[model samples]
Target chain A: MSQRSAGPELLRLIELMARLPGFGPRSARRAVLFLLKRKDQMLLPLADALRDAGEKIDRCEICGNFDTVQPCAVCQADGRDDGVICVVEDVPDLWALERGGSFRGRYHVLGGVLSAIDGIGPDDLHIGPLVGRVEAGGIREVILALNATVDGQTTAHYVADMLEGTGVEVTRLAHGVPVGGELDHLDDGTLAAALRSRRDVKR
Target chain B: MSQRSAGPELLRLIELMARLPGFGPRSARRAVLFLLKRKDQMLLPLADALRDAGEKIDRCEICGNFDTVQPCAVCQADGRDDGVICVVEDVPDLWALERGGSFRGRYHVLGGVLSAIDGIGPDDLHIGPLVGRVEAGGIREVILALNATVDGQTTAHYVADMLEGTGVEVTRLAHGVPVGGELDHLDDGTLAAALRSRRDVKR
Candidate 1:
């Protein structure tokens, strides 16, 4: 048997877990110990989860979000207005919007924006599919809820330019909040500024 | 479908998670949202773990610790000294001792101790097997590392009485920490006091 199989599996799990955010080696050890104590309640289930996800995770074909189901529930929901798609850089922002319970629209996940330094371009994201979704017809508004970063604005403008002749309304989320500031972290002032000052696409 | 399967599974998971120590409902909701956003990295594994552990958890037959295995690793380790057993009230205490890396002996998990007001008795704990283990052979000393609570002392005395004719050296952890004070929370002075005042079993 390998040295990996020699000692307790829980110890190895703790070592891996120690690398996670907010968990130092001491905290990881404590968490592992807690899981061991409540093995029935925590440890075994956690192990099963790790195994299951390792076997089954896949990205949604339409939005590039991780899900077991194809297209994912959000893409398939009947109540969501497909004609008014909210475009975001990642799925976390989509979920943040969903928690607010205000918007009842479909979403287009860009995966990430155009970053010249990172070598990311329009082809790297789901931009082609987003344009197709818009041009397919009946679509009115495309909300650019991307972050306020330069990359995010650049990506927004690039998408707007692509969709210009298609007669769809394109708008970008307002700036003033710091780049990479998640919607969840925004106070009402910043959230309101981002919401109320949302501007029409210039390109 | 059952009502259990009808509502949002993620919501239910968050509700259950909110009750955990150090987390409130808001944090639990945020955690669930975070998991959902990173479904591939966090959610699917967590879900599988919850299901698997829910199915396989059981208390250990010998030491009453929770584990999927019959005899837990600590209980089954042949390298541990059976001659010097450290007794503790809960698995958390056992875990603390394990982290300290000083003790080379095996442990006896009491599960709890004698509390007249709460109706806990010697029979309620694993005291019988403890005495049997001490008296059988090769065992030289029994460490009474129970809490400093009134009931803890009461249970310690009761166990000492049961081992009077056994001739095994029975000793208690010294008393300096107050009742309800956990070893995890104690300073060096208090922990050392508890260590130094350890007395011979007064049967």
Candidate 2:
């Protein structure tokens, strides 16, 4: 292979980029070269930003979102409708809903849905804390924005069952999402349509 | 628009990722969350790798290729045949040829071709240095591995004309490549075919 002309620092950057989802060695090289060409405009700023973020940020204590503070701005917001908490399987889903600008509430991330075959159980999820939040607070609605996976539905049903006598309104994001599709993959129109058509889940 | 549930660090990562070539906020958030969840396995290592790379590498002083050293390993290597120098417009082209496991000689990167419309003249390139190298050494062949663009052809001819009396063989890559196609986009097989079918340019 033609050796990289850059020093250890650039080589490290290319290696890290290669580990990203779709970047291969060729693309990684191109990307690194491009960044180097625009070092003043892109590379140095990106480096400083990443380093600063890495050194300063932490996970939100209340809902598991990213934030500079302990509970995150969303969880700590005074005006947010805390009575309605949206529960999602991943951070992307929460971002999607927030982008719609329709929901003005807080969030609860399960990290991932329960997958028995994958050895992911209830304890592995944030389900316990969700139940605790519902029981301890003045929660009126718990919007389940989980994916339309078999596992997602299973976890949703499990949560709904657990909170049955707690007299809380439990609903799921509507159908129309393709099977095994991720919330992040859906277009804004499709996501909005799904949200608009949401149906309640009865235990 | 979706509020980050994790922390500012995660949000910052997602924001930074969204600015990358093909990623959007949604995908960025998903990627950041995935990296975070797999921090020990992916995120932390990636972050460390980025930091290390940003701190170590530099451009090769001789050929403008990314390198850790000034002259770089390519320029310092005595094993590379000095008789035939393959001249390319960029380092990526050199790397592409190298990936095919062919070509055993050293290289001269012109950085870019002569584009009068873009105000890129011979003086703006490393052509003068290349000529000096050819004149000062026992160089026999100068293979022009520049793109097949009109500008590339013009630059190649100019270089050939400048080195005429030096008794050095000046050759251009074959026209097997279609017009307007970038060498970077061509496959190894196509590139190999082109190289094997290289034609001599009549002055």
Candidate 3:
């Protein structure tokens, strides 16, 4: 025997599965076996869902969010505050904000941050369309909801510079200790920021 | 807005993905986003592989292993010691043994071990077919390469009881410290078993 564990079809499935995020060879093998064990319930549905999403899903031309429509559901939805747009680094970040149900504004996905080491420039993101959206007017404020990394801050600074003369207020998420966060567990920078931005008690 | 983060198509995909073995809601969301970002390269190929596997893969009638063919590659392969059959708890265990390239004998996958808590019994497994193969009168030895868990050992005992009068020898995997295993980290049962099964060193 040639030491081949499974047939080509099963092997191919395992190979592709290992490439997925958060999976390696061993976990992928375990997952494939799990799928095979419940072929009708999980394997077929996941396969169909993948194909359907691939064929039907399209990026929103306006905000770069993915949906089954030309302008994504968020972009097409009514009553969303169109005057205030929140700029996120990626779709997941947009989803994260939306899940909180606090942000009632629109969103613009930048696709990625401006990473110097990765050779990603401002032009590589949706900065042009974002500027166009602001220049087209009626927008009062732009919320930069990017990550707290160095790349994210640099990208936010660059975006703020780009919209300096647009007459629209460009703001960012506040830097402070998170809700339910322990000061002892927080980093020195976060603690310092929290202390610096301390507020007075109304009572 | 209805608090919907994404469209129904993308939502369904995420729902199905969250059902995988190692993925939860957060990791599934991350993975789906990663897939959508590489729709043409990763998502499409994964979907294609899944559909192909679902349509093409078959369970081996003789040994209960999955492959593209009926009897599977392991069953049909020559030069294997047909007289000795290595019994495994599932197809993954068979694959693990095959990857080692040390087992020259054929395999018999039991689908799963007997689990009383889960209401799993001999009838739920491939034990009947295994006994039939042994009774067909060419098999000389049966190696119970099962896990060392309580359910596994109980099932092994039950199988040995069923094959009591078959005139065929029944064996089990050795209990000992594993390769690169540390003595300090070894469990009491394993240390005792290893000491009990010690053999004299050959000159």
Specify the CAPRI tier of model 2.
acceptable
- Give the per-residue lDDT of model 3 (tens digit) for B1-203: 13366777788889988888899988898898889988999999999999999988878999988888888888989899999999999988898888888898988999899998999988999999999999998999999999999999999999899888999999999999999999899999999999999989893
- DockQ of candidate model 2: 0.39
DockQ each: 0.11, 0.39, 0.65
- Model 3 clash pairs? none
What candidate 3 gets wrong by more than 4 Å, as runs, is A1-3, B1-3
Give the poorly placed runs of model 1, Cα more than 4 Å off: A1-7, A15-58, A65-68, A112-128, A135-137, A147-167, A172-203, B1-80, B91-100, B112-125, B135-138, B146-167, B172-203
Instruction: Report the C-alpha lDDT of model 1 over A89-125, residue by residue, as the tens digit.
Output: 9756776777666788778888889999999988898
Q: What would the TM-score be for candidate 1 when compared with the true structure? A: 0.61
**TM-score, structure 3 vs. true:** 0.96
Residues B15-117, candidate 1: write the lDDT tens digits: 5545444446666555544555566665654555444444454556666654556676567767788688888887657767776667778788888888888
* Ten contiguous residues with the weakest lDDT in model 2 chain B: B2-11
Q: TM-score for every candidate vs. truth? A: 0.61, 0.78, 0.96
Candidate 2 per-residue lDDT over residues B1-203, each given as its tens digit: 54433454555566767776656776666666666566566666666665455455566666556566667777677667878889999877877776765677878888889997999998998888788889898899999988877898899899889888999988876656778999999888778988987778883
lDDT of 2: 0.76
User: Across residues A86-169, which tens digit of lDDT does each residue of candidate 2 receive?
Assistant: 999876777677777788899998888999899999889888888899999799999998887799989999889888888999
User: What are the iRMS values of all candidates?
Assistant: 7.3, 3.2, 2.1
